[model samples]
Target: MTTMFRYPVFPVLPGLGQTDIPEGLSRVRSIMAEPDYMDGDSDELIKPKKLLNPVKSSRNHQDLHRELLMNQKRGLAPQNKPELQKVMEKRKRDQVLKAQKEEQEAHKKRSDLEIELMKRRETLEQLELDQHKDDEEQENTPEFVKMKSNLRRTKQEVDGQERST
Candidate 1:
């Protein structure tokens, strides 16, 4: 037995291989193809021959240069007088206040820790005293003494029974 199959093939269009070029790109290409285009004589092209001089300022260059040198030597840029000083003083005051607050907090913590330690020591001493009192009370009790003797007697009786068995 033989199986036969047919596949469909689409025909290629005439304009399918052509792409639409933009008008600007075509104009740019035509301009670039001209022999005199790179000479930069046209107003549309930029010229590198034009030199732009820096605008002259009213201030003296030597003074500005000396000020820059001084600022560099000082390791800081020139700032307004009262405003910068006030800001620096405020920062220093804030730092000092923060340090004082931290020191006070640390001192309070230490005091609290010491107080807690003292309380714990007192509680431990009280517990020890109570334990000592309990021990003395137990020693003085007739019931505890009787229980000790009864335990010894019971142990002897159990040993005798085990030997007989």
Candidate 2:
């Protein structure tokens, strides 16, 4: 048996044309829309944005760093005397002096080591000279020559004994 109740279907409506607009709701277009209400003069009153020129275009960090470095170079970075600033300056001075003292000590140690090395080298040279002089004297001595000949004669006698045995 067929069902008598049916599902409802919705119909699609066409879009409204331009002429379909109501006269009471007509669209308006302005020729001079208030010129965007610019605050250019107020911007001039404010601090200008720091622009990195082509000559210094690589300065990508903040301008404050450059300003501080320049001021420090000119000895103007530090403000009016505060106890903390005085303490920091004193600390820096102490650290610099300490570093200088340590460097001097290191230099002194290096100089002492050099002197010791020179003394050792001189002693070695003196020993070498004494050895050379002893060698020259031994070469010139008749007793040394006779002893060498005796050693050779003993070695020959031992060789002859070994061959005979």
Q: Which one is best on lDDT?
A: 1
lDDT of 2: 0.73
Model 2 misplaced stretches (Cα beyond 4 Å):
1-110, 147-165
| Model 1 lDDT per residue over 60-106, tens place | 76577778899989897665576878999999999999999998997
RMSD of each: 17.1, 21.7
- Quote each prediction's TM-score: 0.24, 0.24
lDDT string for model 2 (1-165, tens) is 887757432222267454454456324321123333264555445554787576555565547568879999998855678889899999999999999999899777777779898899999999999999999987788987879889999999999999999
Candidate 2 has a TM-score of 0.24
Q: How many backbone clashes does candidate 1 have?
A: 0
Backbone clash total, candidate 2: 0
**lDDT at 80 for candidate 2?**
78
Clashing pairs in 1: none
